[model samples]
Target: MAGEPQPSGAPTKGGWITFPFLIATMAGLTIAAGGWTNNIIVYLINEFNIKRIDAAQIANIVNGCTALFPILGAILADSFFGSFTIISVSSLISLAGILLINLTAILDTLKPAPCENGLTVCMAPSKTQLAILYTSLALSSMGLAGTRFTLATMGADQFDNPKHQGVFFNWHFFTMYAGTLVSVVGIVYVEDNVGWGLGYGLCVAANLIGLAIFVVGKRYYRLMKPQSSPFTGLACVIVAAFRKRKVFLSSKSEDYWQETHAGGTKFVKTTPTNSFKFLNHAAIITHGDTTSDGFIKKPWNLCTLQQVEDFKTLIRIFPLWSTGILLCTPLAMQMSLVVLQALAMDRHLGPTFQISAGTMMVFVMLSTSISLAIIDRFLLPTFEKLTGTSPTPLQRIGVGHALNILSMAISAIVESKRLATARSHNLHGNTVVPMSVFWMVPQLVVVGVGEAFHFPGNVSLYYQEFPKSLKSTAAAMVAMFIGIAFYLGTAIVDFLRKTTGWLPNGINDGRMDNVYWVLTVIALINFGYYLICSWLYEYQNVEKNELSSSSPCPC
Candidate 1:
C-alpha cells in the first residue's frame, strides 16, 4: 500500500544529517556579517567622528540595500536557479566583498610615510578609499539578500513528509537564532580587541567556510527546480478570467448555468455573451435579478482571484499583523540607534555587576533563543492541548506585537531616568553619559523576548498564505517589510533632528538620551496601531483545512 508510507520521524533516504549542519553553517556566516556591520556603527561614531544620527542613517542604507535586493534574488531563484545553486553562488560573492574590505585595512597598515620638508609622516588614504569601502558594503548587502530566503526554503525541503514539517520549521528557527548567538560573541571579540579589519576578515573567513560546507552537502539536498516567475502567475490569472468570461456569455438559459453532467462528471454551465460583455463593460450591478436570457455566471478566474482575494481578505481579518510593522520599526532601531546610545553611556562592569554594549547584546540574544525554544517546544504544544486547535500564526504575531509595546515602554522609562541623571550632574559636556549603562538591560531583554515571538510566527504565516510555487517570494516579502521599517525609522529620526535643531547638540555632542525618548513615544503609537490591526484579523481555519486536504505534500 503506497510502499509502506513515508515515516513521520525523518527522511529515511538521503543524508538528512548534513541538512541541519548546512543550515547552521549558513546561519553562523549570515549572523557574523550582520553583527560585524551592526557593531561598526559604534566604531564609526567613536573613530570616524560620525554623528550618532548620521551613523544610524548609514546603517539604514545598508539594511535597505539588503532588503531591496531580496526581491531580485527571489525572482532569480524562483525563475532561474534552484535555491541550492543560488545560495552557493551568492555566498561566494558575499565572501569576496568581505575580503575586499579586509584588504583595505591591510593596505593602510602597509603604507609607508612620505618625506615632506625633511619630516616623514604617514599619508592617510583619500576619499577614494572611503568610496571603495561603501561599494564593498553594498556588494555584501546584495549577497545577503540573495541567499537569505533561498537558504531557508532549501533547508525546509530536506523533510518531505507532512508530519515532519513542524519539526523542520522548529529547527530552522532554532538554527537561525543560534547563528546570531555565535556572532554576538565572535564579532564582539574581533571588534573589541582585534580591530575592525580583523573582525570583517573573520566574517569573510566564516562565509567561505559556510559556502564550503553547503557545497559538500550538495548530494544530500533535494533540489526543487525553479518555476515560472510571479509575473507569470499574474498573467495566468488574467488569462483565466477572460476565458471564463467567454464561457459565461456562450450559455443563455438558467438551466444551462446550473450544474449538469459532462463527461460523467458534474460541471457548472455558464451564460454566454451577456456575462462576457458585462465583465468587459465593467457595468455596475445595483440589483440582484435574473438576466433576460435567464442565465447567470459566477465570477470569472475564481481559482486565481481566490488566491489573491484570500490574501486581501486574510490581511483585512488580521489588522495586528500589519500593525506589527510599527513594532518592527523600534526593533530595527536596536541594532543601530539604540546601540549608539549605549556606546555614549558609561559601561563599567565591576566584579558584581557588569554592563557593556556588547554584553547587553548577549542578553538580548539569549532571551531570543530561550523564548523561541519555549514557544516552539513547549508553549505552542501546551496551548494546542488546551484550545483543541493550535493558534494561528497571526494570533501568535499579535501577542508579539503587544510584547513589543511593553519593550518600548520599558525603554522610555529607562531613558527618562538616564536623562534626569545627566541633567542633575551637569555632565552635559562629556562625550559619554555618566549614568551606569546597566539601566538599558531591561529594555534590551524585553526586545529579545518580543523578537522571539514575532520573527518565526510571521515567517510561518507568510509561508502558509503564499502559493506553493511562490514560497521564496513570500519569504522575501517578510524581509522587505523589516527593511522598510528600518528605512522609515531612519527617515523619521533624520527629520526630527533637522526640525528640532537637535542634530549637532544631540548626536554630535553626545547627549542623545532625549532622542531615545522620542523613539519610545513613536513605538507606543505604533503599538496602538498594531492593536487596531490585530482586532481585524480573521482566522482562516476552513480554508487551511481545504488546502491541506487537497495537497498532502508538505511545504
Candidate 2:
C-alpha cells in the first residue's frame, strides 16, 4: 500500500500531488546553491585578492562544511523538527546568506581593490571584509546542509513502496545534476562575463522562489512526526552491553527480552543476531531488569532486542562507510584542481565564445545526468534480462571504485601531457597554456560516470540498512562521508603545498602532473580496500524484489 497514488477525485494528503512542488523546489534550491559554490574560488581570487592556492583551499573547506553539516540537520529533523520545518527555516537562512554575499559584490567597500596593471602586489581585503565574506559562506553552507539530503528523505516519505522510493531517488539525483548544470553554465557565465552582483542576485531570487514553492505545498505533504533521538537508543545499546558484560549467554528464547504490545501481545518475535555476539548481552533478561508490567527498570542496563540489532547493524555497515572517505578524497581533489587547470588552458569553444573557468565542472554534471539516464532506463533492465539477477548496491559501488581509479589514471596522463605542452611552449609566470579546455573533459566525464554508479548505491545501501527510526539520518550519512572527504582533500592540498613543489603560487611554475599521479596511486590503494569491504559485507535488509529484478518500476 506504500507509495500508492491517490485517485483523481480523492482528497488525499500525499503521493503524486506533492511531486511537482518538491521537484520544483529541488531545482530552484540546487541552482541557488550551485550559483555561488561553483564559482567560489574565482570569487575569492578575483574579488578578495586571495592567492589561487589559498582560494582553492578555502573552497575545499567550504565544500567540507557544506557536506558535513547535513548530519546535524538530519539528526535535528529526525529527533526534534520534522523535515518540513527544517527545510523552511534553512531556506530563509540561505536567502539571508545569498543576500549578504550580493551586498559584498554590489558595494565596493566590502571587497579589496582589483589588482593594479596586472601586478601581483594587490592590497588584501580588510579583516572586516574577510569576516563578512567568511560569515556569508558559513551561513550559505549551513543552509544548504539542512535541506539537501533532508529533501530526499522527505520525498521518499511520500512513497510506501521500495520500488517507488528507488525511482524517486533516481529522478531526485537527476534533478540535482540538472539544476547544477544550469547554475554552472548559466549563473557562472553571468558571474564571469557579466557582473558578480547580478549573478549573486539571481541566486537570491532562486532561493526565494524555492522557499515559496515549499511553503505553498504545506497542505499536501505527508509529514513524518519527529521521534526521540535514534542516537540515544544506539548509545543505550552500547552502554547496556558494557554493563552486562559478565552475563552468561542464553540459548533459550525465554531468557531474552522481546518487545510486547500494551495488551501483553508480543510485538516482534526475533532474537539478537549472532554477528556481534558481545552486544547480545544487552538483550538478555536478568533478575530485576524489568518491572511487573514489563517496563525497563534501568534503561542504560537493559535494551530491547530490536535496539541491540539496530546497533549491530551500524557496527556492520561502518567499515563499508569508512571505505567511502578515501575513495572520495581523490575525486574531491581532482574536482578542485580541474577548475585551476581550466583557468590556465584555452577555454574558447569557438570564435567570440569562451567558457568560464568555474563552468568546467559542468562536464561532470552533464556526464552524470546522461549516465544516470542510461543506467536506469537501459543498462539495469538489460542486465537483469540477460543475467536473471540484479546487481546489488555493493556491486554497483565496486564498479564505481574501479572507474574512479581509471579516471585518476587518465587524469595523471592528461596532466602530464598538459605539462609537456607547457614546457614545449616555454610557458611560465602566469602565461596561459595553448592547450584546449576540452582536453580535460574526458577525466571529468569519467568522474561523472563513476559518481552515477556510486552515489546512489551508497544512498540505497544506507537507507535500506539503517533502522526505520533513523531514515533521515540514513540519507544524510552519504553527505557525512563526502564532507569528511572534502576536508581530507583540503588537508592533502595543504600538505602538498608545505611538503612538495607540485603546487606553487602559479601552477605553471610547479609540477601539477605529479599531484595527479599521486592521486592515481592513492585511488588504486583505496580501490583495493573498497573491494575487501564490499566482499565482506552482507546485505541485511535487501528488498525481496531486488533479489530477482533490477527494474525501478513496481511492475
What C-alpha RMSD separates each model from the true structure? 8.0, 3.7
Clashing pairs in model 2? Answer: 2-160, 3-160
Clash totals for all candidate models: 16, 2
Model 2 C-alpha lDDT per residue in residues 118-194, reported as the tens digit of each score: 69688999999999999999899999888887887788898877677767766776677778889999999999999
Candidate models: Cα lDDT each: 0.60, 0.83
lDDT score, residue 385, model 2? Answer: 100
TM-score between model 2 and native? 0.93
Residue 97 lDDT in model 2? 90
Candidate 2 segments whose C-alpha is farther than 4 A from its true place: 1-11, 160-167, 264-271, 542-555
Among these predictions, the greatest lDDT belongs to 2
Poorest stretch of ten by lDDT in candidate 1: 546-555
Expressed as tens digits, the lDDT of each residue in 498-555 for candidate 1 is 7775445353343354555666777777767765665654444345421111111000
